[model samples]
Target chain A: MGKINIIKKLSFTIVILLSSFLFIHIVNSQAELTSPTYKIVDPTVDSGGGRSESTSYSMLSSQGGALDDARLLSASYRIGSGFPNGIQANVPIFRCAESSTDSGSTNCINFPNANGAQGECGIPGCYDRFKVEINPSGNPIDTLYLVAIYNEDTNTQYFLQSDHTLDTTYDINDYMTICELEGKDTRTGSGCETGGDPNWDLSLQSSNVLNANANTNYTVKARALHGDFTESDWGSEAALTTESPTLVFDIDIGTTSAADTDGPYNISFGNLTAGVVNTPANQIWLDLGTNMQNGMTTYVKDLYTGLYNGTDTIPSQSEDLSVDAGSDGGFGLQIGSVAEDALGPLLEGTTYDLATNNIGTVTTSDTEIFSTDTLSTNVGPITNGRGGIILKALAVITTPGGVYTDTLTFTMIGNP
Target chain B: MNKFLFYTIFIFCTVFTFSNVNAQETGAVPTLFNTEPLEIPSEDNLDLIAPIVANEQINIESSIKLSPAVINLERGSSYLLKIENNTNVTKEFTIVKSAFEITSDRKLKKIDDVLEEKLVNELEESIIIEDELLVIEPYQFKNVSIEYKQPILNYLNGVIVKQRDLLENSDENQSKLDFSGQLASVIIDPTLTREQLDQLKNTITIEPEKSFFGIALNSKFKIKTNISNNSAKLLKISGDITLYDGETRIDSKSLTQNYPSYFYPNDEVSIEFDFNKDERSVFNQIGERSAVKTLKINGEVVQISDEIYVLPYKILVLLILLLSTLMITSFLGYRYYKSPKKSK
Candidate 1:
C-alpha cells in the first residue's frame, strides 16, 4: 500500500509537470517591450540628393543599407530581451492603411509573413533580422526587430516637400498605428490608422498612405503577442520626431480671408496639425515671435510691376504677390498709410496695420501696385503674418463688365 | 452894261450862294459869305472865293454858338454827331450817352510791383456799361457813343427819375428834369411794317439845345438841355459832367452812379453849372487861349455848354498901368523930399 501510494504520487507529479510544460510552450514569455521609433535622422538631405520636388529625407543611418539614398525612415518597434523570443523573435505588426479623417479615425492593415519571410514588416528580409533559432542554443531569441523602410521621398508627406521653401524633418502621418499583432486581424484599439484592420501581406510592397504634416509628434509603442492569449508589456515608445537639427514646423492659411468690396478682410495664419493631436492655432502670431521691428517688404518696386512682362534680377514672383485682374479688370491695389484716417487703400487686416509698415499708393493704371517701403522706425509689434488688401477699382456700376479678380502673393520676411 | 460883266457878276453871286450852303451843312454860320462886298475892283488873280479878299483872310472855325445844336438820325444806323473842339488849346470833352445796362461779371488780380504802381488788366474785354462817357482832347473830335436799345425791361431809369425829380418839391427843378433823357428811340422789330418804323421814328425827336448859350469868364452858366417829349411821350433822362483844364482831363472815378442828373419829363429843368478861367495871356503859347476846348454834353441831353464869353487883354493892361502909376508917384515924392534948400 505504501508502494502504491508512492507510484500514484509520482504519476500526479509527472502529469503536473507535463501540463505546466505545455502551458509554458504555448505562452511566449514577453516581459519587456519598448516604444517604437520613426523619424528623418538627417533633416538637411533631399531624397534625390537634390533640392527639388524629389528631395527626400531619412533618419535611419543605414536604412535599406546605405541610408544616403533614403529620404525618410518608416516607423519601427523594438523590445528588451526579456520576451520569450528575445530581440531576435518574430512578431506581428499593424500599420495605418489609410489617411486619417476629420474625426481622427484610421484604417489599419495587419502584415503577414506570407512571402516566406520570418516576421511581419516585408519580404525583403528586414524582419528576418530578428528570430529565435530552432534549438541547441542557450537562448534562441537574439534581438526583437520589426522591419521599417526609409522610402518617404515620394514628395507627398514631409520628406521631399512640393514647396521648396522649407525641408521637412518629420511628419506625423509617417508614424502609423500598430496593433499587438492579434490572431489573424482582430485589432482592438481605435486609433489614427485604419478603422477596421485588414489583412496585409507580410512582405508589403508599399506604405500607401497620405502622410502627415512636418514637425508633429507621434505616440508609438510595441508589445509581444502570445498564442496562449497572453501579452507582454508594451514595448518602449518609438521616440518619434524627425532627427532634425531644427524643429520641423508647418504653416497654413488657417482661416481664409473673407471677401470684401475693397479687399480681403481677416486672413489668419495657423499651424497645420494633421491627424495628430490637436495643435494650437494662430501660427502667425507664433511666427512673428516678439516684435517685427523691421518692415514687411513687398516684391516689386513702386514704379510699375504690372507694365513689365518679365522681371529683373529680383524676380517679382519671389519678392511680390502679383494680384492680376484678368481681362480689362484692373486690380486696384494700394498699400496702407500711417495716418489714422488715411485716404489710402485699406490693406492689412485689423490685426495688422500695413501703414505700420510702408507701402505704395493705390493705382488703376497699367502698372503693378507694389511697394517695398519700410515701416516707420517706431512701428510696433507685428502679431500676424501678412495678408490684406484695399481695392482701387472703378465704382461698381461704372466698372466694365466681367468678374474682376486678382491673383496676389505675400512674401514675408521675419521682422528683426 | 457889257455882256461879260453881267456874266461875271452872276457867276460870283452863284459861287457865294454855294459857299453859304456848305457853311450851313457844317453846323457853322457863313459869316464870311455874308460879309459886305469889298469896294476894290475885281481881277482875274482874285481867286473869286468868298473866303478871300484884298489882303484879308476870311475866318473859318467851329460855329454853332447859337443855343440849340440839332442832330438828325436814321433807322438802323448808329446815331453819330461829329463835333470839333474849335479852340486851338487842348480841350477835354465828356459825352455821356445813356447806355442800357447789361449784366456782367468782373475779376481782379492784385499785383505787386516794387518799382511801379500796381496796374491791373481786366481779363474780359467787353466794354458794356450803362454809360459811355468820352473825353475829347484839343483838336480831337468825337461822335456821341450809345449802344444797344433798352428793352425798358427794368424801368430802373423811370424809378430814378421818380426818386429825384418827381419827389422834389420845386416846380423849377421839376421843369429842369422834364427834358433829361436820350432823345433817340430805337425800333427793334424784324417784323415791323415800314409805316410802323416811321411812326417809331417820329416818336423820338432829338432837339438837343434849348436857350441859354450866354456865359462869362469865371462865371456860372445854365444849359437848358431839353429831352422835350416833343413826341408827346413821357421820358426818362440821365446825364453826367466831365471837367478839363486845357489839356489835362479830370475823371470822376466813380464805380457806380456815374450820372446823377436823372430827370422826369414835366416841362423842363435848367441845371446851372459854373466854370472859372483866369486870364494870363503874357506867356508865349502855341494855340488859341481857352481853359476848355469843348464841353460835349450828350445823350439824354440837348446840348453841351457853348463858349458865350471871351477873356480880353484888359487885365494884363491894367496890371501894367497900376505898376507905372506907383513908380511915378514914388519918384515925385522922392524928388520933393530931396530938395536940400527946403530942409536947411
Candidate 2:
C-alpha cells in the first residue's frame, strides 16, 4: 500500500511539472519571436525655393554681408476647372509679414501690420497683388504664417484675417494625411511590435502650399508641442541643423536668403532596420546621460556595423530630437526606425545591433571623426516584457562656411 | 510513457473533427468589378448609326451640342457621342461632360500661369451655366458631350429654359411638364384585312442580330416587335436570320413568330428578345473592338455592312465562371468519403 501511494504521488508530480514546463516554454517562445520590418524612418524637409525654382530675387538677402535684400513680391490665384459649380467666395486669412522696407520687411506681404498698416503689402489697391517692399531687418527667424489664400468665386470677393488663418482659411495641417510621408505606429505595446500603428498625430504638422517668388527664399522651423507636463530635450544644439560645422555653436545660422538661421538640425540614419527585430536600428543610439539642456541638446555616437549598405553617402532617415516628459527628461530618442507600424511583432530578449559601415561627420570642407557606444538589456519591465536599450554620443561641429549633412547606423539582433 | 500513441491520438482527433463538420460551406463569392456602361442617348429623332466610334473622322454640317450627351450610366449603361467637322478651318468645340459627383465640396485648383489666368478671366466674363459648344476652324470635328443622369421634369425644364426665359415662356412651358410626350410612342395593330394581316405576319419575323457600326465586338442583336390593335395581325409567320459576309449567308437560324391572344383594336403587345451568337461564322476584325458585318432576315435587308464589336473579354470571363463552378462541384463530390459520420 505504501509503495502504491508513493508511485501515485510521483506520477502527479511529473504531470504538474511537465505542464508548467510547457507553459513556460510557450511564453518564452512567444517573447523570443519577433519580426522586423523596413520603414521610411524620416521625411525630407524643403530646404528652400533656391534648390529647384530659385530666382535671382530669392538670392538677394537683406541681412547685408552675404545676405540678399528683400524686394517687393506679388502673387495671384487663377482658379482651375476643378472649382465647384457654386460656392460663395470667402476672404482669405493673412499672416502679416514682420516688416516692410526697401531692404526687407518683417511684415508679411498680405497681412496687416501694427498701427493699421499692412506690413507685407506695399501696394494698397488689389488683394491678389500684395506689393510690400521688404527689408531684411528684424525678420522672423522662426516659422511664420505668411497668408492663406482662399478664392471664393461666388462672393466675387475675398476676406482677410491674420490670426484665424488656420481655422477660417483651411485645415493645412491635415494635408500631411493625404501625403504618404505620414504613417501610424501599429506596435503591440510600448516596446513589443505587433503590426504597425498610425502616425501619432498628423494635426501637429503643417506643410507649405504657397508658391514662393522665383527669387525669394522661405525659412521654416519645427515648434515642439508636448503633452501636459512634458518638456523637450535635445542631444546637442549643434545637431539641430544640417549646417552643423558652419553653424556649429551658432544656435542661429542661415543657409540662404530665403531660409532663416533658426531651425532644427537634421541627422540622417541609414537603412539598417530590416523587417525583423534581429536587424539594426535605423538610428544610432547614444547615451546623453541624465544631465542635458531642457529644450534641445545634441549627442554623437558611432554605429560600428551595417552602415555602408545605405544607398547614398548621407543617411536616408532624419531625427526629431525632443524631450520625453514622463520618462526621464532626456532628449527623447528622435531617430527614425523601421516602420514599426508594419512589423509583425517586436519580441523581448531581442538584441538589436548597430551597423557602422558608411558612418561619418558632416562639415563645410573637411570631415571629422566620431565615436560610438553599444548597450543591451533583457526585454523586461513593460507589460509585454519587451524593452529596448538605446545608446548615444556627441561630436562638436568645427568646419564652417557651407552646410553639413551626415549619417548614423545601428543593427538589432533577435532571439533564436 | 507512450509518446507515440499520444501523438497519434492527437492527429487522429484533429483530422476527425475538421472532416466531420459535414455541412462545411466551400467556395467563395468571387469579387467582380464591372465598369458602368457608357450611355449615349439619341435626340431630335437622330438614330444611332454607331454606338462607338474609333479613329474615323466625321463631319457635321451644323454644330450639334448634347446638353449632357455622354452619360456614365449605371453599371450596365454606357454612352458615346461623335461630331464631325466637315469645314476647312480649325473648329473649336467645348465638350462639357462630368462623372458622378466625386466630392461634395467641389473646388477648383488655383493655378497662376498665363493661360490659366486668361481662362479664369474668360470664365469671369461669362455668367450663364450653359455648356459652351466651340467648333474649331475648318474641317475639324468637335464633339460637345456630357455624361449625366437625366434630371427630373423640373430640372429638365430649367435646363431648357433659363431663369430669364422661364418668365418669357411661362404658360407655353406648361407643356414641358406633360408626360404624354415624355413617354415613347408605341403602335399596335389587330383585326386587319386578310392582305394586311399577311403583310404583318411576314414583316413581324425574328429580327436578325444587328450591331452598331464600330462599337462592340462579337455582337448579338435582340429584336423586339410590338403589335398594336389598330394594325392588322396574322396567325402564322416564320423568319430566318441570314448572316452575310459581303452578300453571303455565313450562318442562319429560323424561328416561328408567336402572337399574344386578344389583341385589342388599339392595344399593343411587345415581344422582347435575347440573341446568342452562332460560333460557326466567318468574319474579319475591322476597327478597334469593331468588325465589319451585315445581317438580313427573310430575304429583307435588316442591316448593311456595319461595325460589330466582339467583346472577347466578357465571353472569356463568362466561360471561366462556368468552368470553375463545374470543377468545384466535382471536387466536393470526391471529398464526401472523408467524413467520419459517413464512414461509420
lDDT of 1: 0.24
Chain A agreement with the truth for model 1, given as TM-score:
0.21
Question: Which candidate's TM-score is highest?
Answer: 1
DockQ of 2: 0.01
lDDT of 2 by residue, B103-138 (tens): 111111112123334444333332222344554454
Model 2 scores a TM of 0.13
Per-candidate TM equals 0.15, 0.13
- Count of backbone collisions in candidate 1: 56
Docking class of 2: incorrect
Model 1, B48-72: lDDT tens digits are 2111111111112211010001111
Tens digit of per-residue lDDT, candidate 2, span A143-249:
12223232222222112222111112322222111111111112233121122234332211111121111111222211111222211111000000000000001
| Share of reference contacts kept by candidate 1 | 0.00
**Docking verdict class for candidate 1:** incorrect
